[model samples]
Target: MSDRKNILFIMCDQLRYDYLSCAGHKTLQTPNIDALAARGVRFSNTYVQSPICGPSRMSFYTGRYVSSHGATGNFVPLRVGEHNIGDHLKPLGMRPVLVGKTHMIADQEGMKRLGIDPTSEIGVHHAQAGFEPYERDDGIHPDLVLKPGVKYNEYLKERGYDGHKNPWHWAANATEGAEAPRSGFFNDVANQPARVTDEESETPYMTRRAMQFLAEDDGETPWLLHLSYIKPHWPYIAPAPYHDMYGPSDVQPVHRSEVECEDPNPLAKLYQERISARTFSNDERREATIPAYMGLIKQIDDQLGILFKFMEERGQLDNTMIVFTSDHGDYFGDHWMGDKDFFHNPAVKVPLIIADPDPAFDATRGTVNDRFVEAIDIVPTFIERAGGTVPEHIIDGRSLMPLLRGEDVAWRDYVISEYDYFMQPFSPKTGRVPLECRTYMIANSEWKYIHAPGYSPMLFDLTNDPDEFVDLGRDPKFEDARKTMHYALADWSLQYRQRETVSEERAGQMVGLEDKFGVLIGYWDENDIEPPAQMPDYASGLENG
Candidate 1:
């Protein structure tokens, strides 16, 4: 056997769980992810620690909750002295190399790759962190028009394009060819894709880099590489073959109702526009849904094919522990949301496929582990697979090594997912609304217990109401059930989640404090704040006795 095993962590930007072929998807052929899942374990209810990009990515790297990491949103970095998996693996003689997008950090470094000036305020926080982020060469996102498989701009230009244009439109129109030439990704020519490819987009590049690392014997040392992709996420454009991979009618139908506004979460209404790409008629959705969605997934799978083939050819298929997952899930038109950050099924559930490298440990493969798993589990699992140690300080995730070894143990009775409702507070941020009453969910196989601060809570009997159209939390018949799950959310929070404690007087001092420090939004309230107790990390403690 090799002295140590390699870890191939393939992360997609915002892929949902149900989109993969291994998990009951019929129309989309994700042979690559499928092949990996066929040889490993797939979790039916895997979740993201946080729903948004920045916070979720922070949890993966730190293995801590947003409460602990103090990075509850985008635009902030895990504070200095904070431990990260990369920093953790460094001592173990393992180098944690990041090959692609890390939406976790912005600001301090310029967005040189995207060509945005650091001084332009386009980036989130790294620039605020005091590093002169690489200023954009010309100020534009490179991939706007530069997809992998098919070259778009030249094709459009060849077709006699005039200006910029977005090919994706309600009218089935291109944004540029007529008056705009579809507005290249570059303000001038940036967003325009010179090429588009199914697998070529994000997953392929990430896999290629990782495969190169995996194929390298590199003496007796093992490698831990995080292949992060920005695609299958947003600006949802899949390159051809994939772009034309499937018929629109063949796609899975989206969740839409005449009464979308009746959901009453208020959050449901507040973030309506931010979540979905656009409102589509039933007929429009039928024609547009499957083709683009399945095509992107198929593209992601194509890369998986390459990565798996590389592993198999190199004799490392069964010798390496491969973890396949995403930062979070996409809405996919579920609950009228298109992106993530919402706690709906399509937006919250991501695929977690782990393959044990040892034959003796391979029993866990080909089985569905339906436990409530989260992205945080990755680090502990990786640390153990390499025969290294799992650090107590940085990791909140339990190692899957026990499950892999067939130990008779349960992982988590429930999983917690958090979201910030700064956009629409039931009250107001003026110390009047209570920071929009953070929403937390404690979910098990039978139900989902959601606790939103100012608004009435939500409880979905996922077993029965999988669409989550019903509110079981408020139902008197399920009072006991609601209490049971609510307690779980509360109890779990008391155990792991933490946030700043600021009194009214102390809060006033922080009004203009933006001049000095970063913001870490709190998911907890006064009633929720019981501490044994170190104060909030904020200097000059917000709450004075």
Candidate 2:
């Protein structure tokens, strides 16, 4: 085996923090994932920078907050010049490869302005979020018109599944129904089994592609493979055995309350009234959809089992640092919300497990860390593990290698998550301006505060009301807590490292360069300053007398 470490960074989409057995989900038995957790550290309070897909994944790719990266919503392009994981890792001679979803939309306008060809290697890397695309699939192909000739659809067609125009929808995202089959897009039939087999589904397909990449790898070169899976997300439908693995009896009790829906913060109320939220709020819909959601997760776990076994057989496990996490969590009707776009734990907190093959991490095996960590942290972690120094001025997150080594470090006390709802209907319906549609959530171990511009802030005392049944944003009793969180948010906003071009070392070196170059702005006489050796004729032109 090569001395250099190979990183296998696995990310699941819309997976809740507590959905795995190791994370305290009683019914969802994710033995493969739990086994990985048993051999690594599992972070209990990991949060994403954003609750939505594109922004959250962008943070993971760039190691910056949503506000800093400026990709705050789905389909929003990440700026062309933003440095991503591949950018940081490539300099260290580590190849960062992607197998599945990134939800990255290319910055075409920025590319045009820069005069870069879209088909060029540099342009392709920028479009794919800095990864060498092995097989890029965003996993949502509703129709050919919306996304014509998706690669997955073509793969399905080659495997003799071309009955429908978009086989991805019919085979993977639809279920048998009374009278006729219905698309899994409707929550009513989500519990039904999908038309395809488990092997042909999205999770297994992505896993196979990842295994193929590993199989073809030259062992001498170090690499980071981002095996991102799009599953347990909406269009909730599972294939065959996985579909019947769970039912209403296996579905966990929904974490919602009448009080949450009765009198909510204006922003929260808007989310509650969303079509997806209202559908999830129905008892029957929850019963129908959650089982399929769990089934999808179960399928992903099984796929991991296969992938891990394959890696072990190849002797790759001994040399690979395996990281398992999600872009963000799903709401699943938690706090009366369906899709993730809020400050609630279910929407933002995600499961993170890192199993480093290095013996340095053996002491912390199977440990549960409660320190607050964010999605942005993964970038620096990969960079450090690849034998590169972490550029703190460029990356917004700290490397977790210290924590992994069982070393005591001063970690951050709070985490921040942002949401920009301007692209959504919330801005138009509420009549709020585009900028006012943004919201920021700051949370410590005990309390969570949400600050929405032009609207009342929302607060939740996690110590007392862990389920977040009541909103304390308007209550006078917790005004001090709210104010403290606001200060924290403000401090974070002011301290953003947006100047990526200048390093702290470089800035410090620049302090005396002008003075050394014989440019003196304040001086009384020639005796007030020492002239440079290169300029012996230099004079201050002023007299001390």
Highest TM-score scorer = 2
How well does candidate 2 score on lDDT at residue 460? 90
lDDT of 1 at 361: 65
Local error of candidate 1 at residue 61 (angstroms): 1.5
TM-score of each: 0.74, 0.96
Q: For all the candidates, what are their Cα RMSDs to the real structure?
A: 11.4, 3.0
lDDT per residue as tens, model 1, 1-545? 66667776777877888888788877777777776777888877788888878778777777777777766666565564456675556567765655665655443332665566655643423332221112111111344553332222333344443233422221112122445334322112212232433333444545565666665656466666666665566544455556566775566777755555565566555556551435333346435544655566777777767767776887876556788898888665666665667687777778888876687666777888877787788778877776777765447788888877667895687787886655433235324343554677678888887787756677888888777777665568999898888788777777633323443456666563632332334625445343332235466654432
Model 1 stretches with alpha carbons more than 4 Å out: 106-176, 179-203, 211-217, 256-263, 273-286, 423-434, 496-545
Clashing pairs in 2: none
In angstroms, the error of model 1 at 191 is 16
> What's the residue-level lDDT of 72 in candidate 2?
83
Tens digit of per-residue lDDT, candidate 2, span 144-250: 46476577888888888777888888777887566555788887777678888888889998999999999998888999999999988878888888887888888
